[model samples]
Target: MTALTLAAAQTLSIAGDVPANIQRHLTFMRAAAEQGVQLLVFPELSLTGYEPALAAELAIAPEDAVLSPLREMARELRLTAVVGMPVRLAPEVGVLIGALVLGADGSLAVYTKQHLHPGEEAAFIAGQGGEALEWGDDRIALAVCADFSHSSHPRNAAESGANIYAACVLISEGGYAADTALLQAYAAEHRMIVLMANHGGPTGGWTCAGQSAIWDTNGLIAAASGIGEALVIAHREGGRWTGRQVEI
Candidate 1:
């Protein structure tokens, strides 16, 4: 069996700043690559921050100018990256919160969030497509923030044979500890590894809980940032679990 090295990045996102946000993500990407991680996951709406109102104004087409550089970087760095962006759709229903996948060769695969948060309903549409990605022995599924709260989303992912579910979340401080416990239970019940990247600092008057974590299939909190900006890495070797932290 092949052991996978995965990095869950916790950082701050600037509201409505696509260029700077991409740069911030890339900085972490390079660091992860240098550390020899095969996969790097970032937070939801990381490129535009968590301002639902401002996301409407900042959302761009899938082929936007700013994202090209990220695509190029993913290819150059030979890393599989999951990034967040607001993607413009046809017929003016406006944008959707999309998890953009840039493969090692610059190919693109997008997964939109099916479950929308209260505020997001006004700014974006729920995605109608159900999709997952294949990487080595891992069946990867993508979820954004609130999507994981509903059992239906993870159920679909698990039913689709996903060995690992990656979530890009912008979790606020209020109910974070409770949410973490919830995620752990989900991971254990489903027998799948759950990796999440959450934002740090204050954005749009909301303070995010930066406790990025990776839960093993048995639901043990194998690796965690605990609090603040850090990289949480998890891997299993010879049926043994290991986790590490690296300050970014």
Candidate 2:
């Protein structure tokens, strides 16, 4: 079986400061690369700090120079990065909260959130992307914050033949309890490894709970972070998953 080393990063993003956030991402990337992580995932809107009010203003195209460093890092470190950002749509279509995926071989792709939370509908436009990204023998699906709240999210991922369902979310400290329970159920029900990346600081008035985690297919927590900038690295080998954590 093919083995993959992945990292779920819990970080602090500067609200409305895309450059600063990207800088933090690079810091995390270098650390992950040192540990030979194959894939590193960040929290939702990590480039813009999940500020809906400023999403449109901060939205950027996939080719924007602001992400050039990440692309370079991906290629240099031979690591894939699933980074969250606000993607600017063409012409007048508005913007969507999205994930910009950078491949180890200089590939770039965008996956926007298919579902929006109630309050988000007014500020960010929903998008159409819920496909899995293939890495060797693994098919990994991506989810934004609210996508997990919808039943069809994980269902669609499993239907797509994904073995890993990863989410980039901004769960408030008080909301982590419920969200964690739901993710665990998804892992057990779908029989796929579950990975989550959460912010370590406040965003848009909510105190993000930085418990980034990985769960085995059986719904057992394999690795979990604490309430700060941290990294959870999980290795999948021979159909079993085990993990370790590093606080940064």
Candidate 3:
């Protein structure tokens, strides 16, 4: 069987600037492709920062033309990328925190945040989460910022046959410890590999803790990044896991 490479894109998003953030995401995708990464995940609200106040004004449809560049890049590089955005399914429907999957084969899929953070309800609404991504023999599940806060989320994913759990988040320094502990515990309890993508800089007035990381099935750290723009990668080959950090 071929090896699988997964990466977390720890990047800084420009506040309410979709164009600039798209460019930044493309850069990260290129870097990840060079490393032979098959799947790359970005932080929550990566396209527009974590600005809840501006989410409504900045929200767009999943099929917006603005994402053409990123989608094309993913198809060209043969890499599947999960990017965060605020999505509006309709004019009357409230905006949702969305994770768009740009498939290497040029397919598009959307996963909305099933749970909202305390204050996020004012700007965004809970959505029905999407299905797991099937890649080769792997079943990968996705989670948003606050979804993993509930133990039931990961539990359900594992019970549904997911071997990999990826979460896109915007964790601040203050909540880093508890949040990571919970993720680590989930990894151990579920016996699933866990990947967390976090912001590399401050966003939405919160000081971000940019230590994006990946844990093995045993909950041991496979790879982790420090406080800056970087890529945390985990490689699984011949049933063994190895990792590295790349500055972007």
Off by over 4 Å in 2: none
| Ranking according to TM-score, highest score first | 3, 2, 1
Model 2 scores a C-alpha lDDT of 0.87
lDDT of each: 0.81, 0.87, 0.93
What is the C-alpha lDDT profile of model 2 across 65-115, one tens digit per residue? 989999998999899999998887685788889998999999998889988
Cα lDDT for residue 106, model 1?
A: 76
- Scored by lDDT, the top model is 3
Rank the models by lDDT, top first: 3, 2, 1
Model 3 agreement with the true structure over 1-248: per-residue lDDT tens digits: 45999999999999999999999999999999999999999999999999999999999899999899999999999999999999998889999999999999999999999999888899999989999999888899999989999999999999999999999999999999999999998888999899999999999999999999998756656545468899999999998888889999
Please write out the lDDT profile of model 1 over residues 94-145, one tens digit for every residue. Answer: 7889888888877788888888988768888898543687887779888888
lDDT of 3 at 136: 84
TM-score pick, better of 1 and 3: 3
lDDT of the structure predicted as candidate 3: 0.93
TM-score of each: 0.93, 0.96, 0.98
